[model samples]
Target: AQTVTQSQPEMSVQEAETVTLSCTYDTSESDYYLFWYKQPPSRQMILVIRQEAYKQQNATENRFSVNFQKAAKSFSLKISDSQLGDAAMYFCAYKTILAGGGADGLTFGKGTHLIIQP
Candidate 1:
């Protein structure tokens, strides 16, 4: 079974400061995909960033980026400049790389709670 792991249950960061959320996963397949999703108070899980297993370069979007270590199965998210709006529950997810694999949806980790400090 493929499992995603988020070591940090809670983390706080001051405004404008950077913070990194740790994540890891266990997967036997080589071509799987990894993702970091942010769930705000609205409870909508929004995709922050994603890294394909085959991509050597890390994935990034605006202030959000990921450190993807394929061999170690580590995929951590980095927030360049923290904001109050960034406070939310972050979930690490993974899915098979096949065409219909997404039909079953992604397997998500327990999630990490992010708190923005003034």
Candidate 2:
């Protein structure tokens, strides 16, 4: 079975600071996809970043970035100059090579609740 692991359950950073959340997964397939999703208190699932297993370079989206170590099966998210708006529950999700062929859904980790300090 493919499983995503979020080592940190909770994290906090002051306004304007930076923080990184760790994630790792176990998969037998060589080709797959990984994602970091943000769910605010409103419970809306938002895509923060995504990385394809075949890509060697990391993925970045404005203030967000990822450190993807394919061999180590690690994918961590880095939030630079974190703002109050960054406060939310971050979830790491993975899609198997065989899943999501149009009718399947995504598999997600428990989640990392981020608290922004003033």
Candidate 3:
């Protein structure tokens, strides 16, 4: 089993600025994937970014990027140029890669409420 932890329960950032959300995980499996998901008021879980444990390079998507430290088991999300649309509940999640290219159910953190101040 895997577990993810978000130290911050909530974070605030000014519009057009940058904010980094911290996350850490514990797992005994060697093959797995880390992810950052954003859930808006609509209750839709949006994929923000993902990092494979086998990959050394951090994952990035537009203004969203991750600082992945495999050894330290840290995967944090950096939201650059934060916008009102970015305001949501950000969750850190992970799932172990199973044989036959299958994956287990995602394990998510408590989540951090991101507030984009205008």
Candidate 4:
């Protein structure tokens, strides 16, 4: 089984600034995918970025990036130039990579509420 932990229950950042959300995980699987998801007021889970465990490079998408420390089992999301639209609940999740190009169910963290101050 895999588990994810978000140490920060909430974080605040001024608009146009940057904020990083911390996440750590415990897993026995050797191969998997780490992900960051954002759920806004509309209650839709949006994929921010993803990092493959086998890849050494961190994943980045536009203003969203991740600091992935494989050995440390830490995956943190860094949001640059934060906007009001960024305000939402951020969740750290992971899924084990299975054989035959299959993957297991996703396990998510408790989530960190991100607040963007105008």
- TM-score of every candidate: 0.94, 0.94, 0.95, 0.95
Model 4 C-alpha lDDT per residue in residues 1-118, reported as the tens digit of each score = 7899999999999999999999999988778899999999878899889999999988889999999998899999999999999999999999998888665788999999999999
Give a tens-digit lDDT track for model 2, residues 6-95.
989999999999999999999888998899999999778999999999999999999999999999999999999999999999999998
Q: Give the clashing residue pairs of candidate 2, or none.
A: none
- The superposed Cα distance between candidate 1 and the true structure at residue 115, in angstroms, equals 0.2
List model 1 lDDT by residue over 1-118, tens digit each: 8988899999999999999999999989989788899999877889888899999999999999999999999999999889999999999999887774346479999999999998
List, residue by residue over 13-114, the lDDT tens digit for candidate 3: 999999999999999988899999999987889899999999988899999999999889999999999999999999999988888866588999999999
In order, what lDDT does every prediction score? 0.92, 0.92, 0.94, 0.94
Q: Give, for candidate 1, the lowest lDDT window spanning 10 residues.
A: 96-105
Backbone clashes in model 3: 0
Candidate 3, residue 15: how far the Cα is off, in Å: 0.5
Clash count for candidate 4 is: 0
In model 4, which regions exceed 4 Å deviation?
Answer: 101-103
